[model samples]
Structure formats: structure tokens, C-alpha cells
Target: MKIFIAGAGAMGSRFGFMLHQAGNEVSLIDGWQDHINAIIENGLEVNYNGQEFNIQIPIYNQKDLDINSKAELIIVFTKAMQLDEMMKDLQPIISKETKILCLLNGLGHEDVIDKYLPAENIYLGNTVWTAGMTGPGKVKLFGTGALELQNIVPGFEKEANEIAEALSSAGLNAKYSDDIKFSVYQKACVNGTMNGLCTLLDGNMNEVGATSTSKTMIWKIMEEFRAVADFENINLDLDYIYDKILEFNDINKLGNHYPSMYQDLIINHRKTEIDYINGAISRKGTKYGIPTPYCDFLTDLIHAKEDLLDAK
Candidate 1:
């Protein structure tokens, strides 16, 4: 398969290398000039399962993307805020038969993609793999995880299955789900509880999970999320989710891992996906006349921090 990855950050680079190593043609499309240049010069460095290696794959910044290159699949890993711009920039590469998979962290992203490309070409999904970008052309894979995806448009299941199969063959642990929205909600709950707390405290996953205060905050956040999920008719059991999180913490799957939102804040990036995570719950609360004070308060605090950073 000819694949074009649309972010080329940690997640994108990790997937790109895996697919490339599996004997598939993969190219990266990203806006990070330094990262792209470094990859073109020295290949992409991937640290996986305690081993580090480099894989040579074609990478292009938005400016240098070849208009005529036909990609069978385009996996979008860009930040949520960049969706519109990326869709416009990638217009030339999207064909009618091409499948676009959004493995991003958020809700309501499918609507954005449908605005640019045909609905039939879009797929919605979520991933649990933890990865971090250390430097230009370098990505560290902290844990092996799974992917759950589903067809957003009618009559697209076969195509979605084919892509999932290819990703699985590349050792990505991809699975197809009839209830994609549930998968997305589950991931959002995890992110909403973990990412914001970690960013605010300037701590890694294990550090946050080990503290009493952090554990309390996580439960509070999850409670709010559970309330909002109930209002929205999304099937999620707070007790079950919390049990799973504790399991993850105990195994150190997230050991020494800094949340992606924290990394974005430290680097002075333009946006974080918090609005999609906690903010989404707050919005749903407003719509349903349900109270999510904890989530609302945290979302407001994070937005204020973001605003302060923007001013500087």
C-alpha cells in the first residue's frame, strides 16, 4: 500500500517506520521544517522496545508535497486545530478511492473531514499507543498498544477492514469496531483524566499516578466524564475504566511518560487537544443541562494557561 502520514510527529513517525519496515511504501507529510529536513537527511530514528533504529522513508513538508503522488491511504495525525489547513493542503493527493483515517485524539473531527473530502472516504478511529518525539526525526515508542477503527460512512467497511488488516500486519495491533464512538469516548476519558493533571503538575505518568492528590483528581475527572457520558448515552462504566487505569499504572505502561499536552505546552505550540477531551465533556454538559463542574473548571484553567502562553 502507498501510505501518506499527515503529521509525522511521534505517532506518525512511529507508524511510518513500522509500515516501511513491513515492506510497504510510506511517505510522511508534515509542517515541521526541522523534523522533515532531518528525516530527509538522516532517516527517521525510532526507539522501540528498548532498541533504537533508523528507517529511510520519503518525507515532505507541506510546501514540497508532490501533487501527482497517489496515496492509497492517508492517515491524519495532525493536531485537531490543524485539520482544516491540512485538508486544504492535501487536496491534491486525495483521490476518490483513497481512504483517510483519522487516528487523532478528539471528537467532532469527522465533521471537519467530511467538509473537505467525501464522507465515503473517511474513517474514524482511536489508538492507545504511547509515543513521544524527542527531537528532529526522532520518536520514542514507550509502549506497544492497540488501535480501534470503524467506517464513518456507509458502505466503507470493506475498505476500512483492508486498511486495518494492513496496519495489523505491520504489527500495529489494529482492530475494527462497529462502535467507533465508544472507543473514542474511552480514549477521551483516559486523556481527560491523565493529560491535564500531568501537564499542570509537570510530572510523568507514573509520578502522577503514584500520588494521592493526582489519584483523587483523576477520579474526580473521571466522575465528571461519566456523568457527561451518561447524559450523551455513551456506554462507559466509570468503575471499569478506573480499574483499567489502575492496572496500566501498576504495570508502568506509562512509566516516565509525559503527556503529549505537556510537551505541546512546554514547546509553546499553538494548540492542545484538551478542548476535544475535557472541553467536549463540558460542552455536552451544557447541552444536556448536566453539571460537569470539575471538567468545566479544569478546562477553563487550561485555556487560561494557554492564553497566557499565547501572550508571551
Candidate 2:
């Protein structure tokens, strides 16, 4: 399979590395110029399951992505806020038959993707894979994870399964889902609970879980997410999602490290996906006359932190 990983951050790099190792032709496109240059020069160094290997894969920054081949699959790992800009610039490779699998985190991404691609060409999914960027071209991949994907529009179940099978060939543990909206909201709950708190408290997942007041506060946020999800006709199992977010007993899942938002904001001084995660809930809640005080508050806090970093 010919695949392109758009927005090749930590998680994106994990997928790209695995797929390239699985014998697929993979190309990476990301906004991080240094990371792109480093990968192009030294290959992508991945520490997976305690063994490290450098896999040479082609990487392209925004100004350098010249493609003559049509991508069969463009797995989007781009930030929710950057979707529009990415699509406009990615016009060169988006053929009519190209299928876009959005593995990006957060909510309301479908609407953004829909603006550029037809419903038939869009695939929606969520991944529980965890990876950390140790440097520009390197990542620490501990343990393993799974992927769940489904077609964005009805009647494309066959194609969705094909996408899953293609990813599964690369040891991605891919599975086809009947209702991807449930998975999206479920993962959003995890991000909403841990990502913001970790960023605000300057802590890792375990540290956030250790906070005595964490569970109750996280429950309130999940409840707000549940309400907003309900308004959209997506039913999320709040208790199940909450337990998954607080799964710190195992280091492989939701432990030992800061969530992506913390890495984005505090560590790298980059803006976060808060507006599409918690802020999406708040916006939808406002639209439906539902109160999402916690979501709104956290959104404000993250933006303030961004502004603070800018001032520094």
C-alpha cells in the first residue's frame, strides 16, 4: 500500500515507522521543519518495545513535498485546528480515489474534513497507540496499542474493512467499527480529562491521576462531554471512558508520561487542540443549550497558558 502520514508527530511517526517496516511505501509530511530535516538526514529512530532501530523513510516539510504519485491512503494525524490549511496545501496528492483516514484526536473533525473531501473518501478512526518524541527525529514507543476505524458515511463498510486490514498488516491491531462516533467521543473524554489537567498542573498522567480531587473533577468534565455527545446522538459510556483515562496501573496505557497537549503546550511551546476537544464540547453545548462550565473553563485556561508562553 502507498500511504502518507500527514502531520507526522510522535503518534504519526509510530504509524509511519510500523507501516514502512511492514513493506509499504510511506512518505511523511509535517509542519515541524527540524523534525522533517532530521528524519531525512538520519532516519526515524524508534525505540519500540525496548529495542531501538533507525528506519529510513522519506519525510517532507510543507515547502518540500513534491509528489508525482497518488496516495491510496492519507492518514491524517494533523491537529484539528490545522485541518483546513493542510487540505489546501495537500491538493497535489488528493486524487479522486484517495481515501483519507483521520486518526487525529478530538471532535468535530468530520465537519472540517467534509468541507474538502467527499463523504465517500473519508474514513474515521481512533488509535490508542502511545509514543513520545524524544527529539526532532526520534520517538520512544513503549508497549503497543490498537486501532478502530469505520467509514464516515454509510455504505462504505467494505472499504473501511479494507483500510483496517491494510493497517493490520503493519501490526497496528486494526479493527473495523460499526459506530466510530462512539469511539471518537470516548477518546475525547480521555483527552479532556487528562490532557488539560496535565498541561495545567505540569504533571504526567500518573501525577494527574494521583491528585486527590482528580476523579471528581474528571467525572464532571466527562458528564459535560456526555451531555454534548448525547445532543449529537452519540452515546458514550462515561464510566468506561473515565476508567480508561485513569488507567495508570499499567505504564503502557495512560501512564508514565504527559498527555499530548502537555507536550504541545508546556514542552514544545506549541498551541494545543483544546478548541477542538473540550472547546468543541463547549461550543456544541452552547448550541444545544447545555451547560459545559468545566469545558469552557479548561479551554480558557489552556489559551491563557498559550498566551503566557507567547509573552515569554
How accurate locally, in lDDT, is each candidate? 0.84, 0.88
Instruction: Give per-residue CA lDDT, model 2, range 1-312, as digits (tens).
Output: 999999899999999999999999999999888898899899999999789899989888755568788889999998888888887777788889999999988987778888887989999999988888989999988767899999988999999999999999999999999888898889988889889999999988887788899989899999999998888888888878866775742455657877889888898898999998999889989999999999999999999999999722
Give candidate 2 misplaced runs (Cα > 4 Å). Answer: 248-253
Q: What's the CA RMSD of model 1 in angstroms?
A: 1.8
**lDDT (tens digit, per residue) of candidate 1 on 54-141:** 8888888876666677779999999988888898888788888888999999778998899887888889989988788888988888
Model 1 alpha-carbon drift over 4 Å, by segment: 267-270, 310-312
Instruction: For each candidate in turn, give its C-alpha RMSD to the true structure in angstroms.
Output: 1.8, 1.5
| C-alpha lDDT of residue 241 in model 2 | 84
lDDT of 1 at 6: 96
Model 1 TM-score relative to the real fold: 0.94
TM-score of each: 0.94, 0.96
lDDT of 2 at 272: 95
Give the range of the ten consecutive residues with the poorest summed lDDT in model 2. 246-255
